[model samples]
Target: MKTIYYLFGLVVMAVLTLVSCESKPSLQKYFVEKSQSNEFMAFDLGTDIIKAAGSDNLSADQEKALKAVRKLNILIFKSDSTDTNVVHYKEETTKVKSILKNGDYEELMRVGSGKEGASINMLGENDDIDEFVVFLRKDGVFGLIRVLGDEMTPTDVLTIMQLVEKSGVDMAQLQPALNQINGNKG
Candidate 1:
């Protein structure tokens, strides 16, 4: 009886190990792999940068939301239908869709469609949100923004977005980088 019980326990452990190992790949890993090849433009912003970008005019809720955020990762891919690398664009879009669908992510909201598409998604376990993902495809550009936060709620995300829109940060600072990605001279 003891031998049988021990063998059953071992089998259960092996099954659990295999199941954990087979879990879907993280979105962060996918972003890093695609950005490392120089085919995509990537930006990583730590908490300090995010905090500094916010103004003193932030509301209590907005301030709390910002404090919960640990980091932000942005990846952009510019593709034109007439471009030779359009095939690569299609592959990337497909890969992103598959990853989101297969992973634990849940679609929070979706806006626009076809060429002008955008969506917001979240990856969470229990009541804690681990990451927030935003994918926007407009014109010939594809952009992904991943916000890593702790104990984030839906209200917190809304406040964060509101703060971002109201923040006086100058987006023109990114014009040079955007132009480079779009094959335009600054």
Candidate 2:
């Protein structure tokens, strides 16, 4: 009886240890997992794509910002009241917010209100910015843009934005995806 009890205790301890070793799911992991259901569209771009999109005449600030950016992950979901995934969307958004709240992320900016909301948050130490998360919700559609970088600053993001605006990247290309999310067969 004593030997049997010791074995049972060892099994219980092993189970507890495994449970404690599990790490929290990251934003990227959530995006990838939930996207498999076809409720969201995921776009991932590397540094090379960003570099190629810009002009050769990039300013010093723009160059610095572009170089600092290592990767970009975007997930867009169009609100469909009739779809079952709407529940998942709400749950996933709450999870993301909870994760951010528990971390050292700081709000950089916020715009709009009510049903339309947009915010930018950053995670970093001191002057070195590590990640920039942009959450935008408008007209029943939601979008998340995660910019991962090394030693980035707020000013660097501004410069990169300006470069993107001038690069003639077709903004209309995204309209079809947005329309699909809105249940508009375009």
Per-residue lDDT of 57-162 in model 1, one digit per residue for the tens?
A: 6667777888788878888887757666787887887788778878888997899877688888898864688899999887667888998999987778777766
Q: Write the per-residue lDDT of candidate 2 for residues 1-186, one digit (tens) a residue.
A: 999999999999999999987687667667778678676787776655543353676777777988888888888877576556567667766676776676667887889986688888888864689899998877667888899999988788777777666664454656666576668778
The whole-model lDDT of each prediction reads 0.77, 0.75
- At residue 13, candidate 2 shows an lDDT of 100
Residue pair clashes in candidate 2? none
- Show the lowest summed lDDT stretch of 10 residues, model 1: 46-55
User: TM-score of every model?
Assistant: 0.78, 0.73
Candidate 1 stretches greater than 4 Å from native = 1-15, 50-60, 80-83, 125-127, 170-177, 184-186
- Name the best candidate (by lDDT): 1
Question: For this target, which candidate reaches the highest TM-score against the unseen true structure?
Answer: 1
Global CA lDDT of candidate 2, please?
0.75
Q: Which ten residues in a row have the lowest lDDT in candidate 2?
A: 46-55
Q: lDDT of candidate 1 vs native?
A: 0.77
